[model samples]
Target: MKPPRSLLVITVTAVCLLASQGAATWLLVEQSRTAALATAGQTVKRTLGTAAANINRGFLQVDALLSGLESLVAPSESADPAGPNRKLRNLSDQNFLVRELMIVGADGQVVASGLEATRRHPPALKSSLLADDALPHGGLLHGGLPHGGLPHGGLIVGDPLRNRLTGEWSLYVGRAGRWKNEPVVVVAEIPLSNIAQLALPETTTAGLRVSLERTNGQLLMSNPHDARNTGQILGPVSDRLTPGGPWAVVEGRVSGRRVIGAATPALHEGLILVAQLTEEEALADWRETRRVVLIASAALAAVVVLLAVGAVLYLRARDRAAASLRWSKRLLDQALDSMSEGLAVYDANWTLVLTNRRYVEIFPHLRDVAVPGTPFERLARHAAAVVLPAGTGAEREAWAEWRRRAHEGSESFEQTFPSGLTVQSTQAEMPDGGIVSVHRDVTAAKRAEEHLRAARDTAERANRMKSEFLSNMSHELRTPLNAIIGFAEVLERNGAVPEAVRIDYARDIRLSGEHLLAIINDVLDMSKLDAGAMILHESVCDLRRLVGAAGNMLREQARAAGVLLRVMIPEEPLPVLGDERLLRQVVLNLVSNAIKFTGRGGTVDVAVVRAEAGGLQVTVIDNGVGIAPEHLPNIFQPFYQVDGTASRQRGGTGLGLPISRAIMKMHDGQLEITSAPGVGTIAVVILPAVRCAASPADEVA
Candidate 1:
């Protein structure tokens, strides 16, 4: 006899649950350790930062006191050192850190001594602080300073030396300066213990060490206080602290224990502030957290095992009676929910009998009403709003009738909703005269068809425009070449023609050649802009001068066309940074367009002024045949012409406005044209205020 299948399944499930719990416990412990290390690094940085600030502030105070002693003793004044010495003694006693203060003159002699012990005996030429054999790095010559000291007006840090009176090592700091028209050095002695105390505060904790060391890795002071380590060069000990984010962790041997730490450069030149916390101390909290999580997970796993055992007994007793029925119901529900199409059934009386989840989703308005015994007519009425909702009421009613007829005939039909969802529904007759319908959503397929149609239309339109541009280009190019060739032939083949006639033909050839060159230049300029190869040669330029210059160049063209051209630029200098030549071309192109479009006796006005949006504005208004409202949108498209026939008569490549617009965009500006059929046109060029060297208040152009 085989064991029951439910018992086998229960045993396998219990084993998997326990294994998963164990894996979760390991992950939690690892995550806790990472978080603990990150938190420890930040705490170390804060501690080092505070100690460095305090030490820097104290040294600054000592440097300031030394400056006062130099002022009291002057070489140019009456030669009495008594008053200055008394003041120095008072300064030393007042400041607890200051052991002594003195001023020494050039030629290596003491000018004024703060301690009288040095004034009386002057040990081993104490007056000569800068003896040659005792340079700062060289051995001290019998306890005297070296050949050179600090640079002018900057503090110098020197090696520790024993005080003359106390026989204890003290640090001396000095500064060189000019006092009373004489060069002198002021020096002060500060106790080593006082400097050490400033670095190591009273709140220092166990398993933590804070040290102040030279940039050369020479140890100056340590909090956990080692006496023999003073003045010892630690030799690149910072390499031991491996960087672990915002701070560092001590990895290899720095001593016996590993530490998480940070090293900060102190404000005082050539000193490093270090703060270290032992790794064991930093991980103390993480260890206890891991222990608690492990115990809780183990207890929870045990409770789940006991519950599974009780559930197995209860389920085993009823398995034979209830398993078959429950399995059938569940399998049917899953199959309905997993289907891509909605399903619904109606009885012979036309009352709703059953519906899948998708059926309620497809007809959301009837979700609450779709149940056994609800009339099918009422559900159809509720679903009508989603089917072509924008159509007339009569049309909606006709659609409902169509659906009813299709179901009666057992046929398929498609209906579109307001949400753009297209659904295909098919109804079949059952053996008992009932109906079953399946609905499938086809929104993606319908949208793909619409997109393909739109893309085809755009491609056709672009092809037509390019064809027109090519035709126009060919005619304009041939006219000039034909004239030049015809005239040159007359001059060469007919040398017997009169000299006056030949001279006239020669002039025509030159003018025709210039016209041909102009056409080629326009095409090249447009090509450069299209390829993004044009670079603006930016400089500080007067925009007013540029606009005025453009008007001058086109004055003759306007006059030849029998039109009045008015230039209304103010005399104020319009300073802007841009390519001066390109800016002139933009202004020239707009004004030329205005002049060409205006009829005889029409007016074309060009003006430069401040824009309302705190920028520069150039406006060209022409009282002539303006563009129609519908053609305004395409004016900035390359080689686009509103009236192709009118453009041929005006003699242009239809690329002027597009190139001008591109140039404006490069300057971070814009060009706008507003027009009506016969009311004339207003074309404005706006330059952003950022490009204007002068503000709107200053009347920038």
Candidate 2:
């Protein structure tokens, strides 16, 4: 129920201003409002009169023409229908206001259409004119016609009708008479837009809602040519307009808004010309004048308040400054004597405000210049020169600027002095926009931490290596070894074993021996590559045949894993100057790894194509449970696995990719593997163009 705090304050302030000015200011505002409204009312009166005259003048011409038509138009249809129609057409064409003219018989049939008569749209006379036996010769000249339309001082006006053929609206004005003792009617079709044009003033004025309305407040047409507003029962403000009475400006509400309006004496019976100006529009100048005066009054009051407030603030600030000075001196003395840490303070401009004795002792070279009111850049440059004695002038200056920026920015950082002592410095912001920084020696603690960290890292690395080797080598090497030994024992111990069972045991022994040899060979080959002992024995070999051989070796493995392994190669020989043995090993690794990782029903494609880089390449792509992005970068590192667990179902020492890439590098080739987790992987083996035999342009990237 209470007023807003700001509004209440504003009200009190305005009341005070008004009281100081007395009643003169208030009376001036009221007078301005009255003058603006009176002016608007006068303007409305003039415009209303002008519009009324314009409308009446237009209709007077129509009246004179209709009066002449009454005798000219007779029952000529009985003799020559086309002859009468042609005469009426020529007459209607002379006037821009009229649409068309027609003569109808007593039966309401189109006796003659001046334009055209068709079965679809006959210009039949509305029964309102035919049925009515009016008192006057040309019917009620200005009374509303029984059909529809604003009353006009002319022949009887009928409803505004649309020509069905042309889709044009017109006001039907008819003159009824008996020609040769038979009833006949003369009708004039008038365009509604023409009537609206006549009602409008030649020059328009803003903020005026000008329209022609019936005496009963029913709108006939608006000067703005609003067809939708025609026939709308106007507001009560329009009811105040008397068609044949004296014109007066009145204050009233129209269509939910207050307006100043005036009307003219009857332009025609049941018709009045009205013009309205909204209250907001009428009082616009008054409102502007009131705003200026109020603003001036408020400004004067504000000047007084501001002066008083300024004095109070000034006295308080002086006392606070005196107290702050005393407090600062006491703190400085205590910090210099008691504090062990080096401390410095700077103002907002990065000028040295104060420093404790400990700070000067820490950087004795800067002792002379580290004083109050010294720009921090000088002290910082001196400190940087002491810290970086071997640095160039440009480098030292850059260090000084950076340190100055850090001090002003209130940054916490670490630095080492020329004495080789590491200092940890921290900054705090003062309430007056200054900075306070404290520095403590941390050299001894940092040294001890470094030693502990080095020892811990060594111990951890030893433990990790021991665990990986023991877990992976023991499991990988032993599995096939144990199988070979066990299978051999089964055949050796059972001499009475069936031939089929003996053959199976021998086959299992041979398979186990091959798998074990592969694991051992990979380990030895990687060791040779790491020691820089492995070399490519370059020879011209068919790369296509080599890829097919690798595919054949893994075809059964792929089938067992429920993955399709497809090999595509050119029929023509693809000769490459590479170590065929190492190259085969590389392809075997890539294809086997593909099968190992790919899920059931997935596919692995191996294709040989010419490299765009001018050699031949073997592309192996697999839709697999792929290596994650984080692991792809390091996948060619020896013994690296995305999941390094020993119990993982997939078997590998993770040396295959590393050894394969090493062999490719020796041959001046590239082995790239790109993959995304849960999608697929693509491995591209590119042999450099120069290494490709017979042709330099036999490769793809």
Per-candidate RMSD vs. true structure? 19.7, 21.5
TM-score of decoy 2: 0.39
Candidate 2's residue-wise lDDT over 216-314, tens digit each? Answer: 565656666656656566564346655434444555533566777777645445566777777787788789999997777677767756754565566
Cα RMSD, model 1: 19.7
lDDT tens digits by residue: candidate 1, 1-701:
35468878887888899889988888989999989887887778777777778778877888777655575555435666487777777888888777777665554455677688756633222322334342233212232333354343345555555566676556666666545555666767776777767766665355667877766666766776656766677765556542222576665234767788888776666667788888898898889998899889989998989988887877767675676777788899889988888999898988878889998787676778888899867766666656756878887787777666777777788877777778889998889989898988888878888888888897887898889888878888888889999999888898799989988998889988987887787789999998999999987788888888888989998999999999998876888878888888889889989999888999999989999878899999999889987788998888887774555687777888998999999999999999887779899999999988844525443
List TM-score per model, in order.
0.54, 0.39
Cα lDDT of candidate 2 equals 0.73
Q: Under the 3 Å rule for N, CA and C atoms, how many clashes does model 1 have? A: 0
- Model 2, residue 65: displacement in angstroms? 99
Deviation in Å, model 2, residue 248 alpha carbon? 99
Q: Per-residue error at 166 for model 2, in Å? A: 99
The lowest-lDDT stretch of 10 consecutive residues in candidate 1 is: 134-143
The 0-to-1 C-alpha lDDT of every candidate, in the order given, reads 0.76, 0.73
Error of 1 at 431 (Å): 4.0
